[model samples]
Target: MLQNPIGISRLVLASSSPRRRELVASLDLSLPVSVLSPDVDESVLPAWTPDETVRQLSAAKAQAALELLKGRSGAEGDELLALDAVIIAADTVVALDGEVLGKPLDEKDAAAMLMKLQGKRHEVYTGIAVLQSGNGQMHVESKKTIVTMKPFTEEKARKYAATGEPLDKAGAYGIQGLGATLVEEIEGCYFNVVGLPLSLLADMLEPYGIQAI
Candidate 1:
């Protein structure tokens, strides 16, 4: 592989979401990409709005991952810590009429969320935080996407929930998967609803000397 001339040696994603990992890989950056699941409390305060919720969570995840990298001791850990790595962290949430709906606690909960969202328009917010390990500088931003769900019955929502795809996704649906059938249209970055907004992420990465183009 060719070296990254911009001085960023590796890209570390501080998330466990497969959707996020896949989106980052799609960028095809010249540098090596690493995945590190950040361990942090994700409880949202009752006072936090959708925008604030995701932004704080993404920043927390980035900070947790940075601390994790610094605490490692093995050969692999040492190698990773030595590189000038750029850490990408993100958090996403779905809001309907300003009520934030996160991942479902159970299949029933998933169906309920879908029922509330069907035939209605909601907003998806994704907060992205980019941290440079060498300098410890971080940039945080968020993007919003308006999504309209197709009209469907409670039974239909239940059936979709039974498929198990909605359990792990914010808004109880994954626009990139079988959940696409639930979305009638979206007014913003399509990838934002999928979990990460590629265009927004690219812009955030640019200041760190990393360009997807």
Candidate 2:
């Protein structure tokens, strides 16, 4: 069994995002994390609220990772199940009005998203899930952060999109990256806009015997 500096047995992060990993590491938990990107469809359900959409997606990712761990627990005579572990999953989206903005489909789409967001206040929502591998007990929650963007011209939006910085981000911008220049102010947890809300994560982890500090 793998052990971390703090003596936590194992922690799995159900995501492929480097940003999320970095954010987790910043907690200074002194734990080694295994990252697994669960294979799950992220199609938004028409009947779900934007917040619900992200929460459900985050829970689904945790569930998928938990199932995978269970499947591997006894494979090849390995005692994977013997290790005490936990899985963490998160999903984020940008919402303008009632519409959720996901990763852009193309350069044009990214440009359009940025153009629409210019000089507007939008909400960033991130859902987090933490599951204990022992009993499948999990906690899930969603957070919202309001962000105001600088008024920008369509030409600038197109130019920024052409740089490809916004292609993989839900809101066609990353507050921690080149997109910082486009943001006028942030009205909530800054980390939530970045992807993972640290305080929220710490709270969800409490039931699993993990503390951020």
Candidate 3:
């Protein structure tokens, strides 16, 4: 095992998103990462804005994961309890004209969302929460990236949606995958559109004694 200079014994990711898992692993922190997918209500109030929606959801995921860890018993649980673990949770959304667009309900819904996004500029907001198990200290922040989509025909949008890549992605597109063809340009962090913003996350982890650099 590699020595962790950050003083963190474990890292927990409170999400099942493969993209998130991959991003965290790319940091090469050397600490073992435990994944505990939190089950929580994702519905937001009609009045909540995109940023607020993601922020609250991310915090809820962290809290839910913490509760799960607290509920476990026996050797594994006891070992976790003794370690200084950091739980990382995140939520993402696409906002167009201040309207929040989440994962599509179906192929039709994906195609529709893609059609609406084409030839338009939208904002991708990713809310990240870092929680420390040692002291229960938690910090939450949101990052936004502006993406402009290339103008495409409805037929093209439907074809892309048919690929099924957009079904599980916010705004019905994955900028890092086949959906990259649909994007014209991005003005902010590209990783934010993929899901987690690495630079922002690195800064957030700094206070907890974990440094990516």
| Per-candidate alpha-carbon RMSD to the true structure | 3.5, 3.8, 3.7
Number of the predicted model whose lDDT against the real structure is largest: 3
Stretches > 4 Å off in candidate 1: 1-6, 73-83
Tens-digit per-residue lDDT, 139-203, candidate 2: 78999999999999999999889989898889899899999999999999999999999999887
* Candidate 2 local lDDT, residue 180: 95
lDDT of 3 by residue, 114-169 (tens): 99999999999999998886567788999999999999999999999999999999
For candidate 2, the 10 contiguous residues with the lowest summed lDDT are: 1-10
lDDT of 1 by residue, 168-188 (tens): 999899998899998899999
Q: Comparing 1 and 3 by lDDT, which wins? A: 3
Which regions of candidate 3 fall more than 4 Å away from where they truly are? 1-7, 73-77, 81-83
lDDT-based ranking: 3, 1, 2
Instruction: Give TM-scores for every candidate, taking all chains together and pairing residue i with residue i.
Output: 0.93, 0.92, 0.93
Clashing pairs in 1: none
* Model 3 TM-score (2 dp): 0.93
